[model samples]
Target: MSKSKILGSTLIIAGTTIGAGMLALPLASAGIGFSTSLLIMAVLWAVMAYTALIMIELHQHADSSATLHTLAKQILGKKGKWLASFAMLFLFYSLCAAYIAGGGAQFGDRLAQWFGVEVSATQGVVIFTMLVAGVVTIGTSTVDKVNRLLFTLKLIAMASVLMFLAPNVTQSYLLSMPLQQGLIVASIPVIFTSFGFHGSIPAIVRYLDGDTPSLRKAIVIGSAIPLIIYVFWQVVTLGVVNQSTLLENQGLSALIGTLSSTVSESNLAGTIGIFADLALLTSFLGVSLGLFEFLGDTLKKNSANRSQALNRSITGLITFLPPMCFALFYPQGFIMALGYAAIALAILAIFLPIVMVSKTRKLTTDVAYRVKGGHIGLATCFTCGVVIVCAQLLISAGVLPALG
Candidate 1:
């Protein structure tokens, strides 16, 4: 991969990872406290990076032309492929739903504030979902261009918020100890939400011309950017917002509102809101495109050449409908749903790669970029799988803190 390709791939990965969730990081990190959250974030980053490295290695060893589904099929056989496909489908759909819901809530709030109208959140979601679907109906290339633009805008908005909020930070906030009970469990969703870029790995690997070195660099550098951003945002948010405010609000907009009250300008709050809407929109579109591509490929392979219209319609419906319903009915629950999706994605994007590489050990050559501490690396991957499964159970049982 050339430097420009590396840069492009990094932007795609970072953009995909940094959506909607970053807005919620402060609230998510508050329960664990700042220092503890930072430590947890660091550990999660290392784990995610290692898993991503393993994924690249697996991709290198497998048929370069294979999609993620086929990759799973090759290793875990039909059962594994079914599991991986189901998990990924569920994960991406739920995530798209969250994005739609989040975008709708933000759009409605902003619209209501601006126009003095009583627009419900559901109405907002419907309007935005139509907009996204219409744009996607045009072409995939348009969505790609939009993702790049949104990535740039998201970075600017985030940078501005950080800079605007930085002076308000106090040393005491950074050094505070975390609350004891449920902190470990609470950190699960936050970590899961932050390190989510698994959906794009195969496309990224293929985009780099299937070169192992390029794929490794893209995953490492691409993932690192978001981790750094998450940590920085967590620190700034922790310093500015108190625990009481966080617990009471449990949403990103509310947290920003509280933080902005301490600053001299209200414009920063408005800017953050607008930027968040863009970020969520970008995320929704990116994931939606990926889902469509996956569906399209599956249909073409299974149905032969006669199912073009049927394929397109089914793809559109699958990509749009569930998310649209969730957006309309459960707009407020978007962030929590996103956390759930992230956990599922971690399984497909992180755990399945390790399993694939382990099963296809014959395909891996001595020259490939292998993970260090071979058996230990495999052990760590297994531990992450167990942790993710347990975390999912706790989250489902309502035992973890519900941070937006």
Candidate 2:
């Protein structure tokens, strides 16, 4: 692969990984403090990156055009394929709901601030979902081009926010201890979801034409971009904003509001809001596009005789409806949706990759590239996935502290 293709693949992975999910990072980590958050993020990043390489390994055993669905079917049999399909749908829907919840609140807040129009959460959800669904309906080429533009603007906005907020950092805030250590468990679900570019691995494999060196580099470097970004984001947000302020402002809207109010500089505050909005928009575009495409393919497989327009109409409805309702009914569910996404992601990204790779290894030794660490590495990744799922369960059961 040429450097340009490598770069494009790298950016795709990075773009897919960093999304509206990160907006909830500070809120989730606040109860655990900055040090622990950094440690956990690092561990999750390592696990995710390793599993991504494992995915590439699985791809080498299958056809170049094979997706996770096909890989699971071929290596792990029909049962695995069904599980993968279910997990994928669960993951995509959870993420779409999260972005919808977050984006609607951000749009509504923006409307009230910019035009003095008080849009309700339901109205914002409708507007936001419609706008994104319209773009998705236009198809992938349009979405890809638009995503690139938005991704660039998002990076610029993030840079501006980080620079502006740097001077406001308080050493004491960064050094603070966890308010309740058990909340650290609750943070796992959201944090793991933050590194969710595993869905793009098969595409990356095809894009790079299964060049092991290129795939490994793209997986490692692409994933590292988000890790570094998250570190800086944690530093700026946690260093400047008080733990109490972080804990008090729970939802995405409240988090953005807290950032704006905590900062003294109006320009910096405005940049922070813009960055948050961009994060949500870009994430929604990427995630909703994935769901739209998935639903389209599914509809075609079931009803190949249907007209394209009719198929698209059904696909669009399936893609946007449930998530829109979730956002409208639970407007403050940005973090909640993300936590659920983490569970499904653990199954899709972590567990399946580990299982498929292990099965492939047992079946054949002829592999272009294999992720290192053998069974021990696979066990470690599986353990991490279990931990994430259980964390969400414990949080739901009130066994773990859900607060920041």
Candidate 3:
């Protein structure tokens, strides 16, 4: 792949993975103790990397020009297509809603702090949702351009914040672990959420110009970047904020607030807020664009008129409404719901990758990337995904506390 293509793929993966979840990861991991949380993070990275490789293989058999919907139809048939489409739609829309509501609440909180205004959280959510909807409805080209700009700004802001604070993270704090049981389990959702790059697999594959080797390298490298950033961010956050405060606050933005107080630097809090918001916006836009792409393709393929306007409106509504409602009534649940969705995505990533690898053959009978352990590698990936999903379901069902 060319430098520009690699850069684009990395941006897509990073933008998709960072989003609203980054704000919440530290708080979610607070209960699990830092060591256990890091362990879980490592496991998720390996699983997602393997899944990305599987997706690359799957793409080899899929039509290079086809979108995820078409790929699903080809790989799994009609029912499979419907199932995959529904899952993708549900995942992205729910996430967009969460981002809108969560981003608004965080952004509003910062704005309120800065301006001394009292804006209701729900009002903030509505404002943010409208902003996202307006941008998405305009066109993909506009969204793409906005994402690229935001992505650049986000990286700069995050790097600046991290660099300034790097010296303050004490060695003792880095080594210490919070005492909690279910915290790790509860945090699985957030860990999985941080690795939520599966939605971009099709685009990554396509961008590689359908070169299997290039696609494999891109996915692995792209996914690894976010994982490293996430773990390092968690370390910094944990070191900066006390575990008790993180647990008590139970939100990433809240943790940032607490850290600001501890550091006695309001500017640090503001910087984190600005960068975090930018990251969330880019992430929401990327996922929204991908969702719109799949939906637009599906509608055009299945319907006669292919009414782009109608499609945009419906897609906007689907992506906007539910999370807005949840934001209004249950804004705090946004991160939790996002975590659950991540687990579900992990399942899809693992299953689809292995299935595609097993079913497809090389065009020239020369495989570019092969699973080293063969059947054992496949089973390990499958089992890891199953366990993650089951654990998540249990956590969500109230049968288990996520941390426990």
* Index of the highest-lDDT prediction: 2
Error of 1 at 34 (Å): 1.0
Candidate 1 at 217: error in angstroms? 2.5
Model 1, 305-338: lDDT tens per residue? 5657667777777789888897677667676677
- Screening candidate 2 with a backbone cut-off below 3 angstroms (N, C-alpha, C), the clashing residue pairs are 31-404
Residue 116 displacement (Å), model 1: 3.3
RMSD of each: 2.5, 1.5, 2.9
- Model 2: how far residue 286 lies from native, Å: 1.1
Given candidate 1, what's the lDDT at residue 119?
Answer: 78
Note the Cα lDDT for every prediction shown. 0.75, 0.87, 0.72
What is the model-wide C-alpha lDDT for candidate 3? 0.72
Please state the error at residue 108 of candidate 2 in Å.
1.0
User: What TM-score does candidate 2 get on C-alpha atoms?
Assistant: 0.96
Residue-wise C-alpha lDDT for candidate 2, range 265-294, written one tens digit per residue: 555678888888889898888888888888
